[model samples]
Target: MNICRPYLAKLCSTLSGGPVVSGCRWVSNGPRFPFHSVKDIKNWDLDSDHQILPPPSTIFAPSKGRRTRHDNFLDFKRIRVTAGGGGDGSIAFSHSAVQPFGPPCGGNGGRGGNVYIMACKDITSLNGILNNYTAANGTMGSSNNMHGANGEDMVIRVPVGTLVRQVQAPIYASSTAAELGDDEGGVEAVGQDETENADEDEIDVEEQNEIYAEQMMRLLEKHFKFKTNYRPREDRARWLMERLPPKPYVPPPVLLDLTVHGEKHLIARGGRGGQGNPHFVTHEIKGPAICERGEKKEPVWLEFELKSIADAGLVGLPNAGKSTLLAAISNAHPKIAPYPFTTLNPYIGTIDYSDFWTMTLADIPGLVEGAHLNYGLGHQFLKHVERTKVLVYVVDLAGKEPWRDFEILQAELEAYKTGLTARPTLVVANKADLPRARSNMEEFQTKVQYPIVPISAKERRNITHLTGALRSIVEKAGAQG
Candidate 1:
């Protein structure tokens, strides 16, 4: 158990003219310097697991190449979740050498797995979620009356502040299947042409019963291919009990909002297992031969919408320097460019104050003039700011009409939602270093009613005053709420 590093110990022994301690190999550094200096210990083992690194020339490319694009950050997505199906019951009788014929000993099947959804703070986007999810199937029963094993349940974790809503639509599309109902699974009306063509109101009680009886006869024939004896009244009664269908899948009435971390909700429930042959043994009948079939769960469609939750939101038009302002204040690296529409998605950043207090902010994509009417990057990015306690507007002081841009920005927000502009707000006049910025700020101050703060984000000037003002507003909002 050598306490010193392998390279250090080797260096010590080399200088002192003493033998090196070979046992120090256990405490050596990994990957890069497993056995530090190959030339120092000149015995090169070519076939060892630790190989030498390639030359620096091969690692770095000489010429510049076109960059590859990455997938966009997804905040809204849809998924289909299907629960596992129940296992079928067994139909078998125990037989031993002592007794030629024994009583029925069939086992019942196991139920399917359930699906759950949970909210986690670690997850930030919906891009990782799958388009479809299917749970494991239950095992089949055995002849010795052993029950089947249940399927494994599935849990899906998503980011907090997610809204889950079940999509409303018909589970099945075929005319025959819809006529028979959702729980039938093609068994209620196997030959469904007559039932689908005729109107339900016109068909009386007697005609409906007659049509159902005919369908049930066809169902039995399809289920059993071989010739069997189900003619007796007792046998017929036992056979009908085994094919009972599961209940229909019903959608949730209200939308599910997961605001807190670690919150969970059941999205889909599995079907119940079928009954075995012995379960049908009544006083009138000594032994029942029929066994129930397992039930299959229908697939449900759901939509997940993730709305960002932050203390303040930065809103502006394209090339208005909102992204630049966010980068200067907080520890967030949002993409910045001179052209318009540089930010493709909303970016979140946290500002750590000196007193251990912190404020979170989101940089939303630029809003176009007709953004409320679905012109460009419409309400998609607008909803991300709905949960903020304050709104921060960043306007370009270098523009020809700075005050007109401010009024249009406020109008767009008001159009999206009725009272969105009524919250605590701040206006920022960015690019104060430009030639016309000083004169524009004076005219803009007179036209605008809100308090205006002038600062050059590119130069990183006067940021302390802006942050102090924001902290006071945030503190006031926190106290009132």
Candidate 2:
């Protein structure tokens, strides 16, 4: 009888739904068999010579795709986050019999909100950006010296391993076309004087260049200060100066781009609001009471990135009890089932040790053969493996030729990414409870080249051995690094 064939049906159930329960039967003197998930009650073959099979283990993924697969759990490419603009000061007027010309009724404007980047690892994608509030313009300053309200804040979350780059708006050299146009217009007005003014235009261009250079230098000095002894006051002053547009060459605008995994989000921040009328006071309206105008909002861009850090990955074909092992070892409770592919997604678990020590384990989806070629949902499963230092290849030992199964899995890994197979790998032969299991273990040891540890995820046998082995590998990798 094909030993691994009975478990295949159960694998389908696990992938789609939950665990399957099946009767277990073992025969002495025959090949040692472990758990299985066989459905038909009448097919049990309860004769004197027959044994029953356990329900099938769950499977993950319809299988196919090695190349890919992030934030709000919503995928967005870009979003505009506009910080509230500063309110403009108001100009108030007050005239009394005793005291004329009321003090300038102008009040300081409110500062705009500053964007920030916070790091979080649990976030896998940026899908949350779609549901977030769009940018809001700053409130205009009120009359009688009231500053305008600051804008509300917008916080964005991105997955780990993201890289944030400030994308600057393209710098356009002020075109000489303006001067040419002015010359042409002047020629239409005065043809003979046009040539003479050409020299004057050249002189004006040079003067403008000098002014631009000076303005740029002043802007830089006001905004950027790097010295051995830097004071906070000067730093704040510099910050304020930098936000103010440069005198001539508007400092090239900056656009923030956040790249998470392979996805990129360009254009993150929002626009600034217009200023109030308080600064427009003149000598003619000299009063003691009437106040100033409102403030303007500022829009800026920002980026978000994600970084994933894990020490080990518990990987295997679907229904190999990867999630069960994770649940047994860590606080994570991944869906468990009897059929194949029970887990559709990856679940992260933390393993705690003595003295406040701990490590992380990522239980990724199952990968069949040809995962590297993106066959059988392999690509999405493979990426999570990239960050892990060690790979725990979990295998169900009761199935037919578990050792051959291990080899096929290794081939798939090597095919998908060349260096993957070379990484430190541990072979875990699971389901060691049945009568025929011992013989299968012996056969596996003789056939396989790497170290193989036997355990039963259902019976909780030899789990400590696996944990110790994993910890040792993790510690060794750390020390080596």
The lDDT leader among the candidates is 1
User: Tens-digit lDDT track for model 1 on 1-481?
Assistant: 2323654565544333455556533332322222335453443332354432334353334655443221357889888888888777777788999966787677887888888899998887898899999887676666778888898999989988789988754455345446765323444544366667888787787876666665565554433221156533535633653644534557564378988899998888876666667776668656677666666787777899999888899999899999999999999888889999988788888888999899988898898899888778778888888988989999999999999999988999999999999999989899989999988988999999887888999999988988988888888888987
The candidate that wins on TM-score is 1
Model 2 Cα lDDT, one tens digit per residue, 71-166: 123222443344444444443444578867555544444444434443345565665544223434445444455666665555555665544544
Clashes of each: 0, 82
Q: Where is the poorest 10-residue window by lDDT in model 1? A: 25-34
Cα lDDT of model 2 overall?
0.57
lDDT scores in order: 0.76, 0.57
Model 2 TM-score relative to the real fold: 0.55
